[model samples]
Target chain A: MQDPQSQIVVIIIAITIVLLFIGILFLVMIWSYNNKKLQMAREKQQIQDAFEKQLLQSRLEIQEATLNAVSQEIHDNVGQLLSYAKVQLNIMEQQATWGQEELHAIKDTIGTAFTALRNIARSLNILKHAAATRVQIDMLYLPEQLQINIHDNGKGFNVATALTNKEGLGLQNILNRARLMGGAATIISQPEEGTSIKINVPYA
Target chain B: MHIHLYQYTQFLSLLVAILCYEGLCKYKLSAFLPMLVIVNLIEVTGANYRALGYIPWLSNHAIYNLNLLLETPFRLYLMGQMLRMRSNERLTFRGIAFLCMLVILLNYLFLQGPFVFNTFSLILIQILTIVLSCFILLRLALREDIRPNLWQDPYFWVNAGLLLFALITLVILGLQQYMQDHKVMLGGKSLYKAIMPLPNFILYLGYSYAFILCRIPKARSLLSS
Candidate 1:
């Protein structure tokens, strides 16, 4: 039979080895547990980012679609009307018996054409600015709010008309996106002044 | 076992589990209460037999071996169900349970006979359970759609508690051979039995907490966003 001391040493060594193995296993578990937590957090963040990006893309698409429709309406309807009015004024001017009042009316008609053209140019500017608008994003860590402000140097509109106009589908889209993201959106603008749209979304 | 400290712990755990039966029922974990009651019954039966006389064939050790055989597949089934829910994948619970039953039967018939303590089967179950628990935890962590708050989820608590208990038990099981050979030199058989109940305590206490704390989700809705 083996000595009791020698047997105790063997058992101690065996137990120690098993303990070491378990220690290694425990460490591995802790590492994996922390690793899983980090991975979950990363995945959640990616999902949030993807969702937000999709919202922004859809908003842009709607805005671009609305702008295209507006430009088409202006060219096909308002532009055609102005061109016809100009042509009629020119034809009246060429008549044999044109009076002073008729000449004044002709000049007034020309003035209206100029004004219409200028307004058309301003509308075109609004479209261009909308296309080129820069969106600045700032996340407030304290309040956990994401603020997105779109800035444009273009002819602005009356606040009431922009808010209530069915034609301002772009603004409506922005507001919808803000609401979807659990936030609010507002447009700040004055006639002939630049427009700035601010959207606030809850980061949480 | 007439262990004073453990008896109190067991009593507390059983009381809590019984009281929170409604919460467990909501989670479709109503089976847990009856299972625990059966466990307590088995414990009492084994103790009664041991007190009657040290009949090796009808001892607590034999009963433990029998319990291991019955509990392995049932535990696996519950874990598998939880895994399927969290993974959103169709897991073959029946197939896995069948395999476990086969393995335990084979081990009992060949390696560790019916009358003897079945360390091999217990070790095998521990290893498989640990691996499955790890896989579940990894899947939960790597999931993209919604990351659940682990503290709030009953399954998370249950799995975590089981994992902790299994890990410690695995270590003890691994050293079983050494302990068996030097039983007298180390401090005799009671050392092993004394150590085994601790992990059980942790597991039962954890289950009780889960019963109390968790607002279990609906069927197949495991993850909480």
Candidate 2:
């Protein structure tokens, strides 16, 4: 019973409405997709920053741990040996039975102690030297590895103590540096013998 | 059996829905798949009955009317669970569902009397469903801090499909009686017939795609913001 023209108008209106609704759906879809992409990008950036910050914190912690161990070593082992040497010198000076041989023995002992003190001072000064000097670095034809040997003809230290002491960074720092370069550092020494420090480091 | 394109699509959708049951359960969307399967089965049964030369109850509309009744509550359940995940909206979809169910029951008991097609209840359910679907879509679109990739989100795809289905179906159902009375209202018989199945096909296709895409990667499991 509906008029033909009225029915045509209603159908046309319905189709238009449906098409407009579909358009709105598509607009919403595009907006949602873009918003999601932006959110993901923001999340990825936050994750990257968090990872970098953690890496920096851990590196600083390693450095701090090494420094604390080194400070403890200086106060304990090296200081004790130096104090013992001073006590021996004082005893030799006070004793009346001290002869030329005794004097020579004391003199040799004092000389050995002085050389040890100088070695400790040089080791302590190496960091300051690195900071002050801008040494020329050769990058041309860089080898796969570069080996450095440091030898000293002085009364040797306890290799076991240097390697095992928890409160010592002298040898460990060298090892850590070598490891960072994808290489290694090895120490060979014995009591009353000479000492050798070997460093094998990789370079590009 | 001479199965047509619609039947083939329906079976494929059901297969995919079953296979993605794990992903559905993870997001509490498992209830929807069973309801879908039941609806499909009812359609297939109705089709078989007609093909066998048997007169279907109320000319095959009883089964469809039953589908209408079952589908609304399932949709409300899905909407409630989906919203519970993404928003803090104190929705009482359960109460709305119970009320709609009562309305349908009253129509079936008194008005339509269940022997004939429950046209009143059918139209009512369709309108209510369309309104609920729109509400869900609005909440989802305006809600802040949704999944970073809404495409991969099962609920997003599900609700999107529901909204699409509801929108198109609303127009179809609203004009059903009018179109039946006046077949030439939409240009011709062919156009109306073609358009009727299109929304249903699109709805199932969307659900299948959603099932396949609904996975939370182990690293990306921390959803939304």
Candidate 3:
């Protein structure tokens, strides 16, 4: 027969088991709390990374726009003034009596040089316009949209070729700045079709 | 009161379980919630009927063993939650399927037990069960990243609860066997009867809180509040 002492031992054991069960429940709760903390941290990291990328992109786009504006002024206004100056010299030659064939030849040569300068200016203007193509899109669906649109009407190049500019930052700077504005820029073009640049901005 | 303690605790545990289920449903059931309540339901009621009273109840022998009859799927369900949470590339689904089938086979023999003690079958099964439970505790704790650690960071404590119950079960089974082998009476029946529910009550307490934490957001909020 099982003694009373043995029965007491059994009760003690059972009590211990009950206590242990409570302890286990406590442990599982602690684990859940830690899991929540980890999830919160991951969310915070994601937000920070997104903000930094937007800032960097915006800064680059601004630099590109400034360079293009300067290039356009030098190519259009200054180059045109030089062209008119050469035409005035040509009229003076027609009125002068001293045929000075050699001088006339020299004047013609000067005219050719002026013509070359104008052509150079025209190409520079195309390059400047290509760089200036910028667009701002509204992403927030916010009022007033916080949008910026940069547009350029330069010589149309293949969409792929425009993207892979080797000599200059070209569209790259504009793209970088657009990103800073919490946006992205995409160019659509074909051999004959003009490039259409779209920049989508989010609270930029 | 002593005669009714077994029935009372079983009913109490069942009532708690039903209330928990209603609460979980009210909260809009998650994948984990309903299953958890059911786990407690079957374990409590089945343990009540099978372990507490061997005598058939109310001219309903079939109904008396109904919990055991449904136990295969019930036990399988408990294991399924573990395995599903395990995210095991292999053995998870298979493990649940195998255990479910195993329970069917064992229960068939068990219910039929006039069903001999042939070849230490119950002992072997009990041993294997303890080992499996220990493994479960370890798996739940170690795979904390993937599995929802319900007992929070102190997972060892939950495992400890299982271990303690299993050890008690082992000792009881061993005592029954030793007395049978020696052809001796199992001591004073009244003493064992008094203490029998102690281990079970402890297990319930463990389950009560573990489940309550999951089901009742208010309980949790209150803890913090």
Q: What is the lDDT of residue A169 in candidate 3?
A: 56
Individual DockQ of the candidates?
0.07, 0.09, 0.07
TM-score to true structure, per model: 0.56, 0.60, 0.44
Using DockQ as the measure, which candidate wins?
2
* lDDT tens digits, residue span B93-171, model 1: 5666677788888877887777766777877788787777777666665565443455556766677767767776775
User: How high is the lDDT of residue B142 in model 3?
Assistant: 46
TM-score between predicted and true chain B, model 1:
0.80
Q: lDDT of model 3 at residue B76?
A: 38
Tell me the native contact fraction for each prediction.
0.00, 0.00, 0.05
- Tens-place lDDT per residue, model 1, A134-175, is 434444544678777766666677767866988776567667
Q: In model 1, state the lDDT of residue B79.
A: 76
lDDT per residue (tens digit) for residues A68-113 in model 2:
8766766665666667667777887788576788767667766766
Candidate 2 falls in which docking quality class?
Answer: incorrect
Q: Which consecutive 10 residues in model 2 chain A have the weakest lDDT in total?
A: A128-137
Worst 10 residues of 3 chain B by lDDT: B58-67
Scoring only the A-chain of each prediction against the true A-chain gives TM-scores of: 0.51, 0.47, 0.40
Candidate order by TM-score, decreasing, is 2, 1, 3
